[model samples]
Target: MPCVKIDMIKGVRSPDEIKHLAEVVQEVFLDKFAAPNRDRYQVITQHEPYELIFEDTGLNIPRTEKLVFIQIFQQGRSADQKRALYASLAERLEKDCGVPGSDLVISCNRNEKEDWSFGYGRAQFLEGDL
Candidate 1:
């Protein structure tokens, strides 16, 4: 399973824009990452303009209010697959949501299958109830 946490600047995007952004991200996972619908776990958090901190991180990319951070936690993916997923996320989000790759920071943190508890007070991946 993959869970995405999207953080963006508050008051900069309309409600519709945020909703569409989440949709675009989910579509990328479904189409490019091949994740199942049952695996969807997406959360969006808005921060005041000054509350969101960012840096060039030596990439020399300038910061802007349009910046977004997509933190993904998941298990079972090859390096090549992860690369493709990142590329597709940048491309699709730019094309569909008008958010450029330069303004986005996408990171994936791999975890063991036993780390997730989808619901019902169970670790479905280990319990075989998924």
Candidate 2:
């Protein structure tokens, strides 16, 4: 399972836009990351204008209030898969959510299967419940 965390400035997008953004993300994960169907997990956090900060990091990529930061926590994805996921996310977010590639940032983190526990204080992956 891949758990995605989306961070963006508040009031920049409408409620329907947010839902659509999440859906687009899920679609990219399914297509590029090979995440299973019905296994989507995401958290969207809206920060106040002053609460979030994003710099170009010398990349000369101008940023705006529409900046979106995404973090993906997942298990053992190949480098090619990660690259495809990033490219697809940028493309689809731009085409579908109006999020420009320069305004988007993404980080993927790898973890072991034991790192997750779906519920009941049990390691579902280890317990064979996953």
**Top TM-score: which candidate number?**
2
How far in Å is the alpha carbon of 124 misplaced in model 1? 1.5
Q: Candidate 1: which stretches are off by over 4 Å?
A: none
Q: For candidate 2, report its TM-score.
A: 0.98
lDDT of 2 by residue, 1-130 (tens): 8999999999999999999999999999999888899999999999998888888889999888999999999998999999999999999999999999999999999999899988889999998887
Candidate 2 RMSD to the real structure: 0.7
| N/CA/C clash count, model 1 | 0
TM-score of each: 0.93, 0.98
Clashing pairs in 2: none
The sequence of per-residue lDDT tens digits that candidate 1 reaches over residues 20-48 is 99998998898777899766899999999
